[model samples]
Structures are given as C-alpha cells and as structure tokens.
Target: MNQLEQLKKYTKVVIDSGDIENITHYTPYDATTNPSLVLKAIQMKKYEYLLQKSINYAKKKGGLKNQIVTNATDKIIVSIGAEILKKIPGVVSSEVDSRLSFNTEKSIKKAKKLISLYEVEFGIDRSRILIKLASTWECIQAAKKLEQEGIHCNLTLLFSFAQARACAESKVFLISPFVGRISDWYSINYSSNKYRSSLDPGVQSVKKIYEYYKKHDYKTIIMGASFRNIKQVLSLSGCDCLTISPELLSILQAKNKLITKKLFIPKKIYAKPIKKLSHSEFLWLHNQDPMAVEKLSQGIRQFGTDQYLLEEIVTKNM
Candidate 1:
C-alpha cells in the first residue's frame, strides 16, 4: 500500500479543501473547509455554478445588499459542503462567519443557520455536519451551547495547550491544531533546520495535546491540520484525525512507504484529576504563549478578510 493507505490504518484522514472535486480521489473519511478555502474554490470556473446558484437564492430572500451578500456567502459555503457530503461518507465541517467569532450569541446564531441550510435546504442530516468555529472564549462558549442543541463542533485555529485544554473541557467534538502554521512561526523566529518530524514544534504541539487528552481521558477528538509536508503527516500517523491538503495527499498516495505509528495511548495511567481552565485562566495561559496569541489573531483576521473577498464575489454576481 502507498503511504496514504498505510497511514489510514491508524489515523482518520480528512480532506482539507472547499473544492469538493478533489475529495473523491482522496476518499478521506471527513472533509473540512474555512473562509479562505471557500473563497479559493468559488473563484474556480468549475465551481462558478454554485456561486451563481447561491446568488439567486440570496436575491430571492430580498434583503439589503450587505445582508444579501452574507446570505449568499453562507449559501455558497453550504452548497459546497452539501456537494462534499455526497462524496464522503463522514461529516463535512462548514465554518461560521469569522466576523462573528468574538460574539458568542451571533456565532451560535450563525452556526445554527448554517446547520439549518444543510438540513432543511440540502436535505442533509445534522449528524453529518460539524459546525466549525474559532477557538475564542466566546466561540468556545458558543460551541458549548450548540453542542447542547445536538450541533457538534470542530474548533479551528487552535495553537496553545490552553486552547486545547479548554476545548477538551467543553467536550467539543473535535479540535484542529495546525501543524504547519506552528512550524512556520518558529521557522521565521528561530532556526528552521533544528526541527524535523518528532522535534518539529508543530508536530510536538499535537503530540503534547494528544497525550494530555489520553492521559486525562478527555473525549474531545484531536485532528491535526495545516500540514506543510508529508513528513509532518507521517509524524502524526496515529492521531485521532488529520485534515490534509490535496497537494500533500497526492504525494502520499504516489509514494509507497511504510508508516509506523508515532502517537500511542499509554496502557497504564495514575494521576490526580486536574481542574478545568476558567475563562480568565484560559486567557492568561494563552496570552503567555506568544505564538498562540499572534497566530490566533492572525488566523481570525485572515479568515475575515477572505470572507469579505467571498462577499465581494457574491456582490458581483448579484
């Protein structure tokens, strides 16, 4: 078997793309999308019809220009997600608007609306959708409420242990700790060559979180995301899940190699139960980690910008 097949024996592989066309070839168990990916996918000619269809749906709703654009963008995202769900047997994570990230109520509202679109309009089951949210305190809280409503969540842009700890405490369905982005930060600030596979800061971050969850027996799933290379993917061979890009997925599919499990749950455990992170404690610990602070803020802004760009596309079609 190729490396992709080898890795799938342990880790649940997820396709990280809004372009559902590539999803069939990879046959990932799950699929994930964000604002940036949705924007990129909409620009492609093949997905142009989805954009046009969404614009028409928004017009029919008869809202103001800005509201119409927002409506259309959400429709487009859900349309793409619906198409992806047909290809993969597992769930598809459709993100809430990043602009709503800091507002708990609005975040919850948007997530519900997205879920409604998938269930009512697309005729998809709520079970196959994971509402993707930022790891903000507000967003995490928003997820907590949504989870009660039977809306499972996938928290993105998670960087620090604080973020991971909070998600585990909330019993979130899944948390995506970016593997490449962490390495990107350290590469710019420190020596790049010093990190590789197991030693890579990005790889280490996921390993640390995975061990913590296993040791404590937390049920929140750890899905490693944003890999820059196959090495990082191989390093996380035994992760609960790994959302990978098409570029790296194809590389793994082409190369036949043996992949050994890197992460494992210890057979024995003996430890005192640790207290959960309070909102204040979560903020303090996350703030103490400079990389987490900068990256989380950067990720939100980037997603927000891409969302604006997607809205602009909808406006042109309107």
Candidate 2:
C-alpha cells in the first residue's frame, strides 16, 4: 500500500480546504473549512459565482446593507461547506465567528445559527456537520452546552495540553491540535539540535494529548492540523485524524507508496494523568508558555481579520 493508504489504516485523513474541486482528487475522509479558506476560495475566478450568488440572495432579503452583507457572508460559507460535503465521505467542519470566542452564550448562539443555516437553509444534515469553535475556556463551555443539545463540535486552534484537557473534559466531539504552528514556534525559540523532527515540540504536544486521551479512554477525537511539511504529517501517522492543506495532501498523494506508520495503540506505551489546572493555574500556564499564548491569540486575530475581509467582499458585491 502507498503511504496515504497506510496512514488511513491508522488515521482518518481530512482535507482542509474550501475548494471542493481540489478535494475530490485526494478523496479525504472528511473536510474542514474556515472563514479564511472560504474567502480565499471565493476570490478565485471559478468561485466568483459563489460570492455573486450570496450577494444576490442578500439583495433579495431587502434589509440594511450591513445586515445584507452579514447574511450574505454566512450564506456563502455555508454554501461552500455544503458543496464540499458532496465530495468527501465524512464530516465537514464549519467555523463560527472568531470575535465570539470569549462569550460563551454568544458562541453557542452563533453555533446554533450556523447549524440551522446548514441544515434548514442549505439542506445538509446535522450529523455530517461539526461546528468549529476556538479552544478558549469560554468556547469550551459553549461546546459543552452545544454537545448536550446534540450539536457536535470541533474544538480548533488548540495549542497546549491545557486546552486539550479542557476539551476532553467537556466531551467535545473532536480537538484539532495544530502541528506546524507549534513547530514554527519551537524553531524560533530553541536551537536546531533541540528540535528533531521526531522530537519536534509540535509533534510532542499532539503525542501528549493522544496519550492522555487513550489513558483515560476519552472519546474526544484528536485531529492534528496546520502541517508545514511532510515530516510533521508523518510524525502524526496514527492520530484519529489529520486535517491537511491541499499542498501537503498533494505531496502525500504523490508519495503514497512511501508513507509508513509511526503511531498506533497508545496503551503499549507508558501513560500518565494530565496535571489538572485550576483557573489560576490555567492562567499561569498560559502566561508561562509564551508560544501557546502567542499562537492562540494570533490564530484568533488572523481568522477574525479574514472574516472581516469576507464581510467586505460580500458588501462590495452587494
């Protein structure tokens, strides 16, 4: 078997993109989309029709320009996600607004709204949709509430064990611990010798979470994301899932025959209890870990800025 097939034996591969056309070629099990990806897709000549359709729908609603723009943007993202589901066999994660990260109630409300748009407006089933949320404490609380309501969530932008532990405790549906971003931070802070690919800080972080989940039998799935290269991807061979960009997915597909398994059943290895943190402990952890804090904040702001840009596109078209 090729590497892709070998990886699939142990991990469920997910396509991380907004372009449905590209995703069909790789045949990933699931797919994920965020505002930035959706915006990038709509900018392409082939997807301009998606943007135009959203604007035309907004104009028909006969509301204030801002309201029309907001509705249009939401509609476009939902539409793109719905289209992606047609090509991929598994779930499609649709993200909520990043600005709502700190407000639990608002986050839950927005998540419900997004689900409603996908199910009621676009006719996609809820079972195939995973509402994506930031891995903030407030967002975790919001996910807990949504989970109880039978709305599954994909806890995203996760950088540290603290975030992963909290999500697992809340019984989240899945957690996406970023691999490449963590690798990037370690590369800058530590010397070259300190950062081997096998011992990559990012890979270690995901391994820690995977071991913890297996030790406790937590059902929250681990999906590694944001890979910068094939090494990071190979390091996470047996994760529950890995949401890979088209660039990396292409590389994997080309070398499918060479891929080898690195991670399998965690029980064979030693496992330990995750050190639980109180609120103050969590705060201190966040403060002491400069990389986690920086990446968490940066990820939120970048996604938020992309969301605003998407809003602009919808408005201009309207």
Candidate 3:
C-alpha cells in the first residue's frame, strides 16, 4: 500500500487546499478551506469564472459593492468547498469570520448564516459542512451553541492543552491543533536541543492533546493542521485526522512504503497530574504564553485581512 493508504489505516488524511484540481492526485478523505485559500484560488485564471459568477450574483442581490464583495467571497468559499466535496467523500471545513472570534453570539449567528448560505444558496448539506472557528473562549462557547443546534464545528488555531480541553469539554466536533505554527514559535525562541528526537514542540502539542483526549475519552476529534514538514506530519501519524498541504501530501505519497503509525494507543502518562484549567487558569496560561498570545492575535488579524481583501475584490467588480 502507498503511504497515504497506510496512513489512512490509522489516521484520517484531509487535504488542506482550496484548489479542486489537485484533489484527485492526493485523494484525501476530506478537505479544508479558509479566506486566504479562497482568495488564492479566485486569483487564478482558471477560477476567474467562479469570481465573476459570484460578482454577478452579488450585483443581482442589489446591495452595496462591499456587501456584494463579502457575499461573493462567502459564495466563493462555499462553492469551492462544495466542489471539493464532490471529489472527497468526507467532510469539508469552511471557516467562519475571524472578526466574530470574540463574540459568542455573533460567532454562532455567523456560523448558522454560513451554513444557511451553503445549503440554501450553494445546495450543500449541513452534515458535510464543518463550520471552522478559532479556538478562542467565545468561539468555543459559540461552537457549543452551534453543536446543540446540530451544527458541526472544526476548531482552528488551537495551540494549548487548555484550548483542546475546553473544546473537548464543550463536545465540539473537531479540534485542529496546529503543528507547524507551534514549531515555528519554538524554533524562533528556543533551541532545538530542548526537543526530543522527531519531537518538535509543535508535534508535542498535538501529541499532548491527542493523549489527553484519548485518555479522558473526549470524543472531540483531534485533526493536526498547518504542518511545516513531512517530519511533523509523520510524527502525528495515528491522529484522528491531519489536514496537510498538497506539497507534504505529495511527499508522503512519494515515500509510500516508509510510513508507519507513530501515535497510537495512549501510553503511560509521565507528567504530573495537572487539573483542567478553569477559565481564570486558561486566561493565565494565555497571558503567560507569549507565543500563543502573539500567534493567536496574529492569526486572527491575518484572516481578517484576507477577508477584507476578498471584500475589496467583490466591491471593485460590483
């Protein structure tokens, strides 16, 4: 079997891309998309029709250019996600607005709106749509509300155990703990000597969350995302799911026979008993961890900027 097939025996492999052309080559079970990805896709010559169609639809809706652009961007994301579902048999995650991250009610409202847009406008089912939200306190709260309404969520930008624990506690659908971003932070601040062999801090973060979820029986699926290299990808081989970029997926596919399960069956816990943090503790951890703080804020801003740019394109065209 190819490494992709072998990896599937243990972990669910998800394609982290907006372009549908590459989906067949990697054949990931599921796929994920964000504003940035949508922006990238629409910029391509082949996808120009999608962008034009979105603008036409927006113009017909008879709204302001900004509104048209925002609507168009949302349509583009949903359209891409819907098309991706045609290729991959599993779910496709479409992210919510980063601007709504801190507002629980607004986040929930936007999530439902996105779902409605996908279903009524794009004709995609709710089951196949995992509403993506940042792993913030308000976003978690929003996800909890959405879950009760039978809306699934894919929590993104997750960095710490606290975030994972909170998401699991809320019974949210899935948590995407970013491995590459974590590695980036550690590599910038700390030395490589601090990590175990093949155990970068980012990989360790996902492993910690995986072990915790399994050990404690949290059904919230752990999907490792934002991998920097094949090594980081391989380190979480048996995770519930890993959303990998096409580049790394290709690398994994190339070395078909070399893949093996590295993370499976919860091992003996060696760390001291650490109580799941209260909201206060969670805040403390957030404040204490500069990397997490900076990255979380930066991630939100970046997504927000992409969203703004997407709106701009729509506005200009309309």
Stretches of candidate 2 off by over 4 Å are 192-194, 268-278
Clashing pairs in 1: none
Give per-model TM-scores.
Answer: 0.98, 0.94, 0.93
* Clash count (model 1, backbone only): 0
Candidate 3 per-residue C-alpha lDDT over 44-102 given as tens digits, one digit per residue, 9 for 90 to 100? 88988888887787678877656766677777788788889899988999999899899
Among all candidates shown, the one with the greatest TM-score: 1
Q: Which has the higher lDDT value, candidate number 1 or candidate number 3?
A: 1
- Write the residue-wise lDDT of candidate 2 on 1-318 in tens digits: 666667777789998999889888888989999878988998999988888988887788878888888888878888899889889888999999999999999999889888988888788888999999999888998999999999999999999888888898788999999998998988887765546678888999999998878877788999999998888888889888999998987777778456667776665543455555566766676677788899999999999999999998777776
Worst 10 residues of 3 by lDDT: 268-277
Backbone clash count, each prediction separately: 0, 3, 1
lDDT of each: 0.93, 0.87, 0.85
RMSD of each: 1.1, 2.2, 2.7
Which residue pairs collide in model 2, if any? Answer: 2-256, 2-257, 3-256
Q: State which candidate, 2 or 3, has the greater lDDT.
A: 2
